[model samples]
Target: MIILYNLVLLVMRAGYNIAALFHNKARAFVTGRKDVFTKLGDYFRQNHAKVVWVHCASLGEFEQGRPLIESIKKEYPQTKILLTFFSPSGYEVRKNYDQADFIGYLPWDSAANAERFISIVKPTLAVFVKYEFWHHYAKALKQHQIPLLSVSSIFREEQMFFKPYGGFYRGILKNFSYFFVQNETSLHLLKSIGIDACAVAGDTRFDRVYAIVKQGGEIPVARQFKSDQKTFVVGSCWPEDFEVLTPLINENRIKFIIAPHEITETFMAAMESSLQVKSVRFSQAAGKPLEDYQVLIIDNIGMLSRLYRYGEFAFIGGAYGKGLHNILEAACYGVPIFFGNKDYEKYQEAVDLINRGGAFEVRDYTDLKAKYEMLNSPETFLLACEVTRLYVEENLGATEKIMHYCRTLLA
Candidate 1:
């Protein structure tokens, strides 16, 4: 089985190199491992402080670990951070983050490469964000006796861990010194596998988002649409989300800021053509002051999470596809949220929020109209807003729990 796993890794590496000819992400797949080691070798020779290595799979996991990273910085001022990302998205966006002393794509997790990379960094502590589990990397850490921990771990039966042929993967779970899972369901899942180094630490993203909600930003454009009135931010939206929402914007007594997930020209054209009112793309309207249009179509990225702070209500996107967008971002503002019900199972926060009356999952246009009307009454709308805020407050402490656990493991 072990030999088969090695063969699989070899083929995967070879396949990735071939794919690199077409896609930019596969660049790391074919990089010279010796050169990678040489670069790290030079960096390591100069670093005198104990290093804390943190790995996050993508942007979502990066956000989940941001609060923890900042917390570590404050607590262990002398420690150096070696943050590695498996996905380009996280590495690209957060490469400039102040806390990470060294940020790069994690070398492909072959045993030899993992061992070489681990030995060079000499990480005093290692943290894995969310669900990424690379067997070679974990095994190397264990061999070096570096305490491995997972922050904001969430497990489900549908994952590879619970599959019938998941023994090789399941064997890797025991490498962690502790697992700070998002909920009891995940802790129970870990326990079922006899890997009980776990706790229900919730998610650090709520901590990061709630912190954002508290620190308000000037949405010079969005403010124009609101003008001292209630505004809904439809965030990280795709075409399907906009297709369902464009009709609702025609209704009177509602204001909107539609921040589509992709800000491409094609998507902006579709949004403008679909809407009933005068709409302006954010890129085009960047020089203009807020209030030039009834609907502000945000053809920009990086601001959607922060934009949630300005909204009385929010409708996150992605439910029309594989899962719901970041409902938690809006939830942290205590803003009531709405979304389609297509990919409902993947988003635990949405299900939990709707069950608590802090969110709504619109089944169809009919259900959307009913909910919108119910919120039309000023009194009921204010009540709903309060429910949303209260929900955020109720779930505010996950970061503290995670921070405490990390401190114990940090050098």
Candidate 2:
């Protein structure tokens, strides 16, 4: 099984190298790991502090792991954090994150790389956020007698760990010293497999988003653009979502602020071409009269969370394509969120919000229009807002529970 996994990694690395020639993201994935071991070794040699390693697969997982990271920094001020990402999406965005002492790409999951990495870092503890289970890395951590934790984890029966021919994969779960899972289903799944070093700690992202609400300050541009108008914020949108949303945007009933998932020149231009109403990109809005335009296009990243503060409604995109982006970012603001009605069942919050009447799923233009109109009434809108707000508040404190467990482990 280990040999087969190594073979798969080898093939994937070769495939990515070839793909790098033509793709920017693929190129980043290949180039970012260049001399990563030398970098890790050089950084750790002089530091020699008690290090806690936190591994996240991408940006979403980073958000899920962030509250815990910051909390660890606060409680264990002397302990150094080594944060690693498996994808460029997370590494590129948060490479310079201040909470972690060291941040880098996780060297691809080979036994040799894992052994070398463990030896070089010599962490007191290792943490894997959400679905980041690496066979070789888990084994290496166990060999070194390091405590490994799985945080904000969820498991489904369809996963290999529960399957008839999945003993190799199931062995990976046993490597973890403990698990802080998201819900009862995950707890039940692990218990059924005879893995009892786990508990339901909910999701750390709830704590993270609530912190954002407390710390959120005003974005001058967002405030200026909104300027007393009923605004709709569109976050992490894709071309597919835009196709369904463009007609509604053209109607110009309410002001719209769109932040596309990818800010590529081509996609932005395509979005602009499709919109019939007057619009302005955030970059160029500095000199223009902000209120003159009906649509405001966000041309950069990192402001979507704060941008929700100025909106009364939100459409979080990505469900129209691969999967749903983070609705929790917008939901934290207590807005009635809408998304494309596909592939959102995987998100527990989305399902909960839909059931609680805090969110709605739209299939197309007609679905969007009808559902959106239903929320136009002040009474109905306020009810949804309260539901969404209370939902976020109720889910808080997962980080504290996980931290309490970590205190015992670290002691």
Candidate 3:
């Protein structure tokens, strides 16, 4: 199985190398690993502090892992954190994040690479956030007697670990000292596989978002743009989302702020052209009168979370395409969320919000318009706001629970 995994890795590396010629992300993936070990080695040689390693696959997992990361740092102030990312999206955005002591791309998961990585960093504890499970790395951690954990893990029956011919992957699960899963379903799934080192801790993202709510400050631009109007914030939107939302924006007298998932010039231009109302880009709106335009297009990243504060309600994008983006971000502000009716089954929060009357899943423009009208009522809007706020409030404290377990493990 290890041999097969290595072969697969080699093929993937070759494919990435070839793809690098045409694709910028693929190119970064290939280029980022050049002398990765040397960089890690130099850092290790210089810093002899006790290390806690946290691995995340990408941005979503990073968000899931963030509250724990900050808590760990607070409790173990002397311990250095070595944060590793498997994708450019996470690493690129958070490479300069000050919380982690060191940040870098995780070297490809090969036996030798894992062995070398474990030797250099020698983390006292290792945490894998969400779905990342590398066999060789798990094996190395086990061999080194490092306490390994999986946080905010969710499982489905279709996953290989639960499959008939999944012994190899199942072995990887055994390497974890504990699994803090997001739901009871994940706990039951692990139990069926005879994995008892697991518990239901709920999703840490709720904790993260709740923290955002408490600590959230005003974004001047967002505040200026809203300016007492009933504003709808559209976050992480895609082209498909715009297609469904454009007509709604054209018809409504309410203010709109759209932050697209991809902020490429061409994509922004396409979005601007689709909206019939006067729109201003965030970059250009700084000194200008924002109230003159009906739409404010966020052309950059990093402000979407803060932007939700100024919104009366929100439309979370990505459901029309791959998956739904984070509705919890908007929900934290006690706003009713709207999204496309596609691929929402995988997101437990979205499903729960729909059932709890905190969110609406619209199939198209007509459905969106209808839902908007439904929410336009003062009584209905207030009820949905309370429901969303309560949902977020009820789910808090996963971070504290996980941190308690970690303290016990470390003690």
Best TM-score goes to which candidate?
3
lDDT of 1 at 325: 76
- Residue 229, model 1: lDDT of 69
Give all candidates' CA lDDT scores: 0.80, 0.92, 0.91
Please give, for residues 256-283, the per-residue lDDT of candidate 3 as tens digits: 9999998899989998888889999988
Candidate 1 residue lDDT tens string, 156-243 = 8888787889888888898878898888899888888888778987878788887776776776766555677667789888888877
Show how many residue pairs clash in every candidate, following the order shown.
3, 0, 0
Which 10-residue window in model 2 sums to the lowest lDDT?
Answer: 208-217
TM-score of each: 0.89, 0.89, 0.90
- Each model's Cα RMSD: 2.8, 2.7, 2.6
**RMSD in Å for model 3:** 2.6
Give candidate 3's whole-model lDDT: 0.91
Q: Which pairs of residues collide in candidate 1?
A: 237-261, 334-388, 334-389
